[model samples]
Target: MIKHIGVVGAGQMGAGIALVAVQSGFETSIFEPSKQAQEKTKAYFQKKLPPHQPLFVTQLDALSNCDLLIEAIPEQEALKIKLFQELDSIAKPEAILASNTSSISITKLAAATKNPERVMGMHFMNPVPVMKLVELIRGLQTSDKTYHAVKATAEKMDKTTTTSKDIPGFIANRILMPMINEAFHALQEGLASAEDIDTTLKLGANHPMGPLTLADFIGLDTCVAILEIMDKKPCALLQQYVNAGWLGKKTGRGVFSYV
Candidate 1:
């Protein structure tokens, strides 16, 4: 029943989700305040999914009619809460509001909305078009009806679904982030060269990409943010890299140089 989908934030994740939603035959709209980001998304769609694109809107009110609104903003809790509060007042009473947060608490986000039952988490993997998994999280007050509707919507978009409780880091990041952290720890200890470490994991452990490379792909800053939210001890090396503003591929440098 989610015929109209709206996406907030025109970053890689948001634009990717909007692409999938529209390709799946849903009426999709994307709301982004930044014209630069909007242009980037437009260019991305033209290259990756020509002939189909979501409506780009500058105002939040344009999403008021969306049957489902997915927030894919940065990984900041305060920013997300503030956006949800505003969305709660603008969206239709029955519309569902979902967050694409990787490690934040769905229940806490739901609390910002007036109708908690319609607030849930729909954590789509990065590069939404390629990733098959979509983690569906039920907030403390999220209703079964809302969960099912969102699950169906995910299926319509051809994504496999997994359910998670309202936990910090949820399932994916709870396990993944720690492993990435250990990768940094190993690097700091001089246990192996970054290349050898990545090679060992790729050939030995059979991981698609080495942990350090994956961290870069996910954004080192984002990795740190998720770890901080999970209350994990800081890894000095990771902090130093983040401090240098080498936020992985986006910034052209991270644990390794992308330039």
Candidate 2:
């Protein structure tokens, strides 16, 4: 019976999640501190979402009535913890506070809140509007009721759910990021050109896109950040690309140039 969904952050993932929430018929509120980001999200929604306007708030106080608040901020542990602490104090007592973290520990994040039972991970894949799988991660103290409620909500949004214990990267990225990293290694070692590496995976593995190409789409800097959070050593070449500010399609350059 969750309604009045609130989403913090108005970046790519946050905007996508807010779009899904509204499409599912819930009254949605989006909180974004940056006016520039808010403008971008507004333009996106005007073009892609229903004509009905969603409340865009500049402060968390507006989200107090939300039954489910999903934090879609950048993947930083300290920032997430701070936000959760504030959310725990602001949101309704029974509200479920979820994080869309890709690699961070859900349990650790839950600890920041007073009511750990209401804290869990609702990790949506990139391009949230299109992706079907939503990883429902239960932290150490996440209640069964909270887990089921979020699962049902995901289903209502036409998304499939896979449950996982709170672990680094949960289920998806623990395996996916490493493969992307390996693709970078192959390119760095001169095994093949970026195009050839991707073509091999596309034809041999039947993947929709090649690893290098996918890396560019996902953003090279994001890939390195996830690997580092998981305590995995990132590919040196990937590091170099990030250092050069070639953060993939967002920056118009990465493993392959989009420019």
Candidate 3:
């Protein structure tokens, strides 16, 4: 029944979600405070999408009447709570608010909103256009109606939906980040070059992308932020690299460099 969608944050995830929604024939709106991010998001869809997608949006205020609002901000609890508070006032009484948080607590996030029953987590993996599975997480108070609604929304977007319990890192990233942290440790011990480390995982683990490469795609700053919250310290290599502002592709540098 939800025909319109709103996406907050306009980061890689938000823009990608907005593209998916608009391409699926939903009227979509996206909110991004930074003028640069907003412009980049718009460009991403314009250049990356075919002409058929009705990517009709100019600014943030278009979100108020959207049937579902997707929050795809950085992984910060305080900021997310603040956003929910604002959206609670702006969105319609029956609109569903979904957070695309990979590691944050869905229950805690749900409680931050005025109506917890209307809030839930819909975690889409990176490169949204390509990822097939979408994790649907229900908070303690998230209504069953919201679950089905979100699942249906995912289906409409051509994504397979999987249910996850409210927990730290949910499914993929919990196991994934820890392994990546271990990889950092290996590098600091002079086990291998960054490329060698990545290659090892690709061939040995039969994985498509190495952890460091995946981390870069996820944004190294985001990795640092998540690790800080998890009380995890990567090998000293990452600490020093972070100090150099070599966060990742977002900054044109990481384990691998990008121009």
Q: What is the TM-score of each candidate against the true structure?
A: 0.97, 0.96, 0.94
lDDT for 24 in candidate 1 is 93
Cα deviation of 122 in candidate 1 (Å)?
A: 0.3
| Candidate 3 TM-score, true structure as reference | 0.94
lDDT of 2 by residue, 1-259 (tens): 7988999998888999999998888899999998988998999999995746689987898999999999998888899999999999999899999999998888998998889999999999878999999999999999999999999999999999999988788899998999999998998899999899999999999999998888887778778889999899999999999999998886788877777
Candidate 3 local Cα displacement, residue 247, angstroms: 1.9
- How big is the positional error of residue 245 in model 2, measured in Å on the Cα after superposition? 2.0
Per-residue lDDT tens digits for candidate 3, residues 1-259, read 7998988988888888888888888888777888898778768877986445434455545688899999999999899888888888888999999999877788888887788899999999888989988999999999999999999999999999889888777777768888888888887888898899999999999989998898888887777766766667765777777888998887899888899
In candidate 3, the residue pairs with backbone N, CA or C atoms under 3 Å apart (3 or more residues apart, or in different chains) clash, namely: none
Per residue, candidate 1 scores C-alpha lDDT tens digits across 1-259 of 7899999997878988999998899999999888888988998888886456689988999899999999999999999999999999999999999999998888998998879999999999988999999999999999999999999999999999999998889999999999999999999999999888898999999999999999998898889999999999758999999999998987889978888
TM-score of 2: 0.96
The candidate that wins on lDDT is 1
Per-residue lDDT, model 3, residue 103, is 74
Residue 54, model 1: lDDT of 84
**RMSD each, Å:** 1.1, 1.2, 1.8
Give the Cα lDDT of each candidate.
0.92, 0.91, 0.84
Give the runs in model 3 whose Cα sits over 4 Å from its true position.
51-61
